[model samples]
Target: MVLPVGRSFYVTTDYGRVKGFRYAADNGRPDAPVVVVQGGISGTGQLWRLDGSGWWQSLYDAFAETEDLQVISFDYLGGLGGSTTPEQPLTVEQHALAYLQALEKLGVDRIHGWVGGSFGGVLGLQAASLKQGPPIDRLTVIGAAHKPSIQSSLLRSFQQLLLQNCDCEQQGVVLARALAMLSYRNADEFERRFEHPDDALEYLLAQGERLLQRHGKQANKLFTHLTPILNDYHIDVRQITCPVQLVSFSSDTIAPPALVSELEALLPDCDSYVSIETPFGHDGFIKNVADYQTSLSQYLPQLAETHV
Candidate 1:
């Protein structure tokens, strides 16, 4: 197995300790501009640890080679190897505080940019809006909104119900995750990938099995506790003063274009809104990273001058 190559440490926070990893840029500057890349709910801080076979390997390599750029990322406070399981439900503000405290511990007073999608994106927004956290210079949000839409909220509620009704928590998590996959992807992807009904059924079952193996029996409890926070995510956008770029996929159902548009109008300093066409739905942020990067490059000249 290819393991993550970096130093790992923990930082104390209001919620608990957060696990983080630091990747120094090869440009040989210790005081380099720092960029934070965060992933969705099912991910960890080790997301950028790319092997050659993974889709993200090229994207990781691209940033790793950027001059005077350092990347720092941490796992969510309640997930995997990060902090202990939440004793109570964690709000978006609490999640933001944990991330702020982690960076404070690392002596990061100002962030060059913060990139996140879905759950991570909303958390970034919440963090930037807070008066107590480190200042963010630039922000990139992909397929996320200030709060869950009515359709998305209803779907999550159903997933939660399914999780609570199962006899085995592991099985429940598997089912819930499978259902979430449907939301992450569009109908066109399913039609193209599966020729027959049996293939589709098999694929979903496999994905569920993988989740069960990765999360064990605690999967249901963890998601059950976290779902409400995701649904209730809200922040005062007027508080955000940094330039922001919002990217939404045309096919994304969870964080659709209309919701992203509403978020863009609310931001006091929104730089641009780029809508990309993709069949991957809400997961297009990862599925079409090359296109996403192309959109981001438009702001590169601006970022460079700001850092200089």
Candidate 2:
């Protein structure tokens, strides 16, 4: 399934060239309020996925669906899609600053709302903490943490090790992606999705193959660039002044609900903590889109009433 995307735009910054996509309402109102949506590391700025029926539909579209705002999304500085390679090693802080720089270039002085999933969520928090990015009226984070857990960090290290040692880099990308599937989902989901070990293996193999086939040689570089960002992500939540909404899955191993919950205290204006119960683990936010939409619909309106 391939989601259709618009022509790419570039924002050159100290980090180098950053590329992004823009989604706006039909009126083409430049003055429309803006919302930013950042996807997981594996995905590009194409917010929707092509379903099996060959239709492009966004799993998360509440922001795009809103009549009065524009939606902007971008790739990490050296990520798999859209963006180009960075001149220097990337850090989470640098990634955040890159997005801010791009937004500034785009003439977005203030963000109406910022929604990020997984690593994208971490970037959102980090950007907010910088206190130097565009003003953020509200932030919605899905399955993100202020600091990664020791377990997730170790898992990423093992992935990096696999990538570092392999003679064939694409093979390494496949293996690392397969391993990452384990962290993205929980045992219960595995049990529910597959009838047997062989079935599970087949699914993982298909996922890995799909990743390699889609990204090709760029796969390894994407993984290499993202792991460092994951390891270095730590935010000073007190610096965040915007209203925040945290949505975490009960079964997420990468960003467990407890760890995500901790952000509620540190964030000066956290408005809500929504725990979504699902066996899908870290991927629950994607797997259960309706649930997230319900929450966002209820919360985003408040942003307009109070902050817009």
Candidate 3:
């Protein structure tokens, strides 16, 4: 079921256009404008995932089947998808500015939705509280923070350390998968996914081996990456005021559903929430795309009626 998927590209910033990715116009409706953002790390945009996170695929397969929707995505600075520009003092605000400039350059006036996962979700929050111009019409953020928790900060520190000292590709993947899977859920989801204790270890071992085989060696970029992530993590989310629709995986241990509770409490206006009780945890937000389409389809009409 190859649903209509569109081109992947990048928008030139003042720094110059680096390659990014987009998914646009499934089933022949180009006018319906939506944009997607990947998280803040150096990872490639998940227009299609060969590895761990398959959530983007689920999102597209669900939306592309319907007509009248246009979606786009991109890679952020310091990323493998970005140019090697010094980017002089990159911050979340700066990142949002780049995205704004791109939207302006593309002549996109307003958006039906601004969607992001992880770091992408941070920018979405920024747009909600935008002081510069018109706020985004709607926000859909899954597993993002207005601020990093203590554990999250510690993990970021460890990632930076790995990038600097060990620089082991295998270690990086091992750390990433371990940390990421842990935050995504508690013991419940893992148990379900593995079906047995020994199976879980086997699954994790297989997962780690495969990941290290590929992306384990991104330490060069990771070393260059740490500061920016830490900076973004410290941003004050109080500025975001736009209407929000939050999604979380009960299994997601990284950006736990509890974090969403904290964010919801802080938002100028409390909004909606949907939690997918899957073992998939943080990655589940991206991987379990089918569950989301059903969620979106049911909720969107309600959102329009209420917001409109």
TM-score for candidate 3, residues paired by index = 0.77
Error of 3 at 193 (Å): 5.0
lDDT of 1 by residue, 1-308 (tens): 11234457788877887888766644346566777777777766775554544323434633643655667778776665455667887788988888888898788988888888787789878888997767988888988988888888887888889877999877787888888888889899999999997898788878888877876765554575566678887789889999999999999988999999999999999998889999999889788777777666556543344333
lDDT of 2 by residue, 139-184 (tens): 8999888999777888888898988899988788888988888788
Per-residue error at 50 for model 3, in Å?
Answer: 12
Q: Which ten residues in a row have the lowest lDDT in candidate 2?
A: 49-58
The per-model lDDT (C-alpha) reads: 0.76, 0.78, 0.60
Task: Please estimate how well model 1 matches the true structure, expressed as its whole-model Cα lDDT.
Answer: 0.76
lDDT score at residue 290, model 2, on the 0-100 scale:
71
